[model samples]
Target: MIKNILKSALNNFQAFLVTWVVIIIVNQLFIFGACFAPYCLLAALPHTFVIAVLLNYFLNAEESNKQLNSSKIDSNSDFKYTQADNHIEDNEFEETEIPFCPKCGSKMALRTAKNGAHAGNKFWGCSKYPKCKGLLNI
Candidate 1:
């Protein structure tokens, strides 16, 4: 139900596009009905961008929390866990292997934003930089 929807949308690629397309379509319909101009599409960009950014922030935070909890539980096993599991390694978990870009089927590179509000945060960027700007936040 709700959990399945959230997991599917958060973890899958096609679901992401479907979810956003529906949102945009509905928003555009409302704007068209009220304003009756194709030019309003440009005005919709900022609204949609802000919504997407905010949603990404909260979803990423929740996903990180879930992973942290799961890793802690796993660290309790008989095998020696990494020092970070027992409070020795850096506070951050080791960077996991990056997945291929869902959009373009290209390799994704780990990149840090040199200039932005998220300047130091790491995210995955598509190898096809100028052509395909697919991204996945880490």
Candidate 2:
């Protein structure tokens, strides 16, 4: 019930107007016992304002998270992976199959082994780099 109110409030000004009216009516009838008193509506203002601010904060946060998630790589289409056997010395993956990191689940990127015995050879490394040391042979 509260969730529905919040969702509606996020999308429509009518929901806020309705919520304010209900708060004012309830305050005037139950708290003040003077249904016609104008001052009784004042008491509802703070309550309505606090609820509006809190709902706005939470709903906007949810919207931002949705946008962030939508911008992420699709995995199946965004990255191109190639056969591990076609080792190109540069940062480019040959053009066959994309592999996920074994240690973490992130997509792997083509990287060169700069200093080890396999220096100058190309392999798949975790896109996350220093944070995740997942590696694969190419």
Candidate 3:
């Protein structure tokens, strides 16, 4: 049962990765070809938009999977709980290491807010919140 679940998850991940790679290759081809004609731009735009949407969907799925797995750790089991606690501590420590925002050199933290009109996916908002309002894709 566990193997089947893992296999399914791996297959989905592989498919997602392949799709993004192909999207990148196609984008590069379009860019290098310098095809700015209306029809060409129109064709590429929809493909790019569709890929972006699908990528966002997969990202949400991955995040939910992580959360679900974390929640499944048996707190009543000493060994399991200890391992989970250690893992959580390690993640917190790693998060502290990312000092500056890759975008604007501001501090960042894990944040939750409405996923905008996009719905479903959560994002990392700048710690500066209303003032900076910078959002990072999770």
Candidate 4:
């Protein structure tokens, strides 16, 4: 996806450069005709703006459609379950008490901080606050 986006941005830049080069060449040609230069540029300006606007609109629409399709598939998947089903109850399970960090074997403790994103808000922080101070966004 990142590569695709980079390719698209490069393509748009190349196209924009080619278009302005052509426009400049045409305007230069009309300059030799004395009275037609201004008129030619005036005519080309509106068309260029229109084409640019249309391209932007279509690109946005395509991106929106891709997002919508992915979300639709996620929502329609069969594996999703509600919280109350009790197939996996969180509180019923015994929390593993670790005296050391699993990754580095350093001392660890049960701490709480803001975590996870809900709706439009993003709130995330390390479970070990004021000490570990590892913050994140979810």
TM-score top scorer: 2
Ranking by lDDT: 2, 1, 3, 4
The lDDT of model 1 is 0.70
Extract clashing residue pairs from model 3: none
Clashes of 2: 4
- Flag regions of model 1 displaced more than 4 Å: 1-15, 34-38, 56-64, 76-138
As a TM-score, model 3 comes out at 0.26
Q: Estimate each model's TM-score.
A: 0.34, 0.37, 0.26, 0.25
Tell me which of candidates 1 and 2 scores higher on TM-score. Answer: 2
Candidate 4 has its poorest 10 consecutive residues by lDDT at 118-127
Clashing pairs in 1: none
Per-residue lDDT of model 3, residues 17-65, tens digit only: 5665577557857674865566766667666756744664555567667
Best by lDDT: 2
Per-residue lDDT of model 4, residues 1-138, tens digit only: 545544444556665456555655565466435334576667667655545444544565576578779999998897767677547767788865445443444555544444545545543434454555543333
Mind giving the per-residue lDDT tens digits that candidate 2 earns over 53-131?
4555465667656765777745446678877885667657445688999999999998888997999999999999999
In candidate 2 the C-alpha lDDT for residue 9 amounts to 65
Look at candidate 1 and tell me the lDDT of residue 95.
Answer: 61
| TM-score between candidate 2 and the true structure | 0.37
lDDT, candidates in the order shown: 0.70, 0.72, 0.61, 0.55
Q: How badly does each model clash, as a count of residue pairs?
A: 0, 4, 0, 0
Superposed model 4: Cα runs more than 4 Å off: 1-38, 67-80, 83-138
Candidate 1: tens digits of C-alpha lDDT, residues 39-107: 776777667645554454455657757887999888877676555445565757776786899899999
Instruction: Choose 3 or 4, whichever is better by lDDT.
Output: 3
